[model samples]
Target chain A: MATILQFDFPYPGPWGEEGARALKDLAESIAAEPGLVWKVWTENEAEGIAGGIYCFADEPSALAYRDMHSARLASFGVTDIRAKVFDVNEGLSAITNFKIA
Target chain B: MATILQFDFPYPGPWGEEGARALKDLAESIAAEPGLVWKVWTENEAEGIAGGIYCFADEPSALAYRDMHSARLASFGVTDIRAKVFDVNEGLSAITNFKIA
Candidate 1:
């Protein structure tokens, strides 16, 4: 089973192209995390927030990564992160073609 | 490129296995919708909400489907759907191993 880790935090600027540039290496690195499957980079410039929805191999990995990511962002001077982890409904998700293998 | 549709609405009961059973047919049906790539069903039982994060073929398909979904949910006595659409940042998404194909 997989888990989804969703998080967001305040980022007043550097969205879209600029954000892409700033986070490119970080994005690539997270993609290489041991249990990671994928991530959907999310941003709402007008809403003053940025985050990603990540799919991980399982709950333990998801939780571990959440702690690691939260700390990493804090080291980058982003401390007010909002994070949540969900159990991926695999049986239901397959109906929408979400890759489970 | 893909468009991301994020939405949530009040649903106080039937989470996890029960929710899966209730929404299974709807999930299968939506999977067959034109331009839909995938949807990750989400729920917060304590928070009284249910929704999904969806990836679609393009922006127009996303918006069109959002309207259609809003209408459908309303017909099911669910009228207060909260929805937002985002243009997928393909380059950055690719960096995170998102399947943009």
Candidate 2:
């Protein structure tokens, strides 16, 4: 079953077009991460926060990525990271088109 | 273009098997809502909250539904109904598999 990983952290800037352009490489890297089916990048630049809802092939890969991400963020001095993972309720999800890839 | 609507509100129960069973009708009704593409149900049962990340056909439909939903929640005494709508960045999202359908 797939897993949904959601997380947010204190962040500022680089969420708009300019930021997207600047972060294209970073975005590409994330997209290429193994087991990551997709991600919806999220940000409230004005509120100084950013996160993403990620769909992963499974839980282990997602957790590994989360740990890696947390460590990376910590290296950059980001904190107060909040994260959670949920098992996809495929039957209920299908009703809402949460398709299984 | 698609829109993502995210919201959260306090709730004490009905997020597990029993709650889902009781809310089956509500879930079906929501799935049948016009302009709704899908909804990934979310809940932090321990924290007493429930919401979902909803994909809509367009921004207007999404906002319309949001307003309607807010009214309905109020009628049910659901306060603090937070909501936000975001335009899907198709290109960037495409890289992360946010297909525009």
Candidate 3:
């Protein structure tokens, strides 16, 4: 079963292009992690939040990535991050057709 | 079971606060729809993309929101949107603890 990981983080005080640039770099790095299938990155300026949906090949891969991401975000001075990991049920929708490779 | 809905859309050419504003309005409207539990909205300027992760009470509610959202986007001249729906497997992770209502 594919693992879905979702998370959101609030930008530190007075976020701007610089903060976004840093996040972009971080997101790109996470996307390259082994077993990562795909990720959708999102940001909301007015709300001062950013997050994404990620799919991984397995639970271990997803959990590993989550730990790495959380630590990286903390190092960047980003706090108040919320994350959840989910197991994808193939029978739910056409999502079974979505594959990483 | 809680239904997870994830989607992304490229903002129409040269998007700005105007596009985001319109999307906020649409998002707020969708959140009010019955059976919707929560939604996390995101945007990216450099990438020119916006999206969110949604939790719904059931499949029918999620699908209904999708149709409405698509039509609203079309009316706003947006195109090439991507969407996927997933059934949350409670046993997969701790996601079963996340609930609507």
Candidate 4:
């Protein structure tokens, strides 16, 4: 079953196009992570928060990536990172038009 | 551009297969909603919470669905729903292996 990984942290400024330019390299690296299927970059400028929603092949990969990413963010001076790893309800999700596999 | 809609509320679920059985009808109805690209049903049994992460074709559609779903959930005696609508960074997201098209 696929796993869902969500993480967010407080961020200041540089959203939209500029934000995309700045994060392009990091985004490319995330693409290469083991067991990663996809990721949707999320940002809230007014609230000053940023995050990504990710899908992984399994829980193990999600957990591994979560730990790695959390550490990476901390190294970048982000101290308030929040992360969650969830088991996807694949059967029910499929009925709602999301296909895993 | 796609919009991400995330909503979750407290629920004591009979998770796993039984949960699927219980939500099948609701899932089907959700699949038919306008502008819905996909929805991944999420739950945290240990925390007694349940919700979903959804992709809608646009922000208007997402907001509309959010209002409708919130009302429906309330009708089911579920309050305390937390919902968020986010704009997707499509260019950045694609680099992370997710294509919003």
Candidate 5:
């Protein structure tokens, strides 16, 4: 079963088109992360926040990514990062049409 | 272009095994909703919260589900429901290994 890791932090600029251009490299780097199945990059311009919902192969991978990503974000001057890891209810999720491959 | 809707509310009971049994019907009903691609049920027992991350075919579907689900949760005595709709950066997300089909 995959684990879900969600995180968000305050981000003030470069949303929409500019954001896509600015974060391309970062996105690629994240894709290469071990045990990362996929990541949905999320941002709320109105709320001034940016983050992602990630699916990892297991809890260890999810936690490892969270720690590494948190440090990376901290290095970039983000002070308030909110992150959580959840055990996915695969049976329920499948009933709601969720799929993992 | 799918939309992402995430919501969480204060819930104190029935996590883990109990949660799976309790939420099965709800999951099926959610799956039958229009334009719903899938849902990832999420819960954080330590935080005493429960919710889901859903992918809908469009913004309207996402918003509609949020409204309906919020009301349902409110009726169940959940007073504080936090919900957000996020526009996906699909191009960037692709680089991060995200796919929606």
Candidate 6:
């Protein structure tokens, strides 16, 4: 089953171009992992949070990515991170039938 | 079963305080809808996108929110909106057991 991992963290304060650069580097690194299928990065300035939805090959891989991501976020001094892992139910909706590019 | 709605879109260009203010207004309005349980707004400048993950009471309510949201995004001249709806399977993962505030 495809597993979905979602998480978000606040930027402590306003994140300028430097922060954007850091996130780009981190995302590229994480996406390079073998088990990750794809990821859709998301952001909302009004809410002051940033995160992504990742689709992984399996539960173990998803959990592994979670650990790695958590460590990386911590290294960047990003605290108060929240995340969840979900098993994608193909039968749930027509939207689930198609993958997000 | 709880339904999950995830989507994102580019901000066209740099979005400053005014853009954030517009989003805040939209979010507040959406959250006030009768069927929405909760939503997590996410943003990332490096990727140049913003969006959210929402939980709704059912499919109808989820779809309704999508239409309203899409229209609002259009009003703001935001294009390339992408959205997907999922039925939350409570048995998926331990993380699914807890909701993001």
TM-score of each: 0.79, 0.77, 0.47, 0.92, 0.92, 0.48
Q: How much of the true A–B contact set does each candidate keep? A: 0.59, 0.34, 0.00, 0.79, 0.76, 0.00
Could you tell me the TM-score of chain B in model 1? 0.90
Tell me model 4's lDDT, rounded to 2 decimals.
0.86
Summarize candidate 6's per-residue lDDT along A1-101 as a digit string, tens digits: 56667877775433434444545545556657867776645454455766666767777998888998899889989999877665443322212123322
Candidate 2 structure quality by residue, lDDT tens digits, B30-97 = 89888898887766666677777788988799889999988988898998887766655455666787
Candidate-wise lDDT, in order: 0.80, 0.75, 0.60, 0.86, 0.85, 0.61
lDDT of 3 by residue, A1-101 (tens): 57777777885332334444545545455646888776655444555666656767888998898998898879988899876665543322122122333
Candidate 5: lDDT of B1?
Answer: 60
Give the local distance difference test score of model 6.
0.61
The segments of candidate 3 whose C-alpha lies over 4 angstroms from its true place after superposition are: A12-24, A95-101, B1-101
Instruction: Sort the predicted structures by TM-score, highest score first.
Output: 5, 4, 1, 2, 6, 3
Local accuracy of candidate 1 as per-residue lDDT tens digits, A1-101: 67777777887767778878987888888889979888888776667877877888887999899999999989989968978777666667877887743
Docking class of 3: incorrect
- Candidates' chain B TM-scores in the order shown: 0.90, 0.91, 0.77, 0.95, 0.95, 0.80
Give the CA lDDT, 0 to 100, for residue B76 in model 3: 78
**For model 2, how does the per-residue alpha-carbon lDDT over A1-101 read when each residue is reduced to its tens digit?**
58777777877766667667877877898898989988887666555777777888988998899999888879989889877666555546666665644
CA error at residue A15 for candidate 3, angstroms = 8.4
Tell me the tens digit of each residue's lDDT in model 3 across B7-91. Answer: 6788533333454444554545665678877665534445566555676778899888888878877897878876656554332
Error of 1 at A78 (Å): 4.2
Between candidates 5 and 6, the lDDT winner? 5
Candidate 2 regions with alpha-carbon error over 4 angstroms? A9-11, A44-49, A77-82, B15-17, B44-49, B74-82
Clashing pairs in 6: A42-B43, A43-B42, A43-B43, A43-B44, A44-B42, A44-B43
Give the residue spans of candidate 1 off by over 4 A: A45-48, A74-80, B44-48, B71-82
lDDT (tens digit, per residue) of candidate 6 on B43-91:
4455576666676777799888898889888898998997766543232
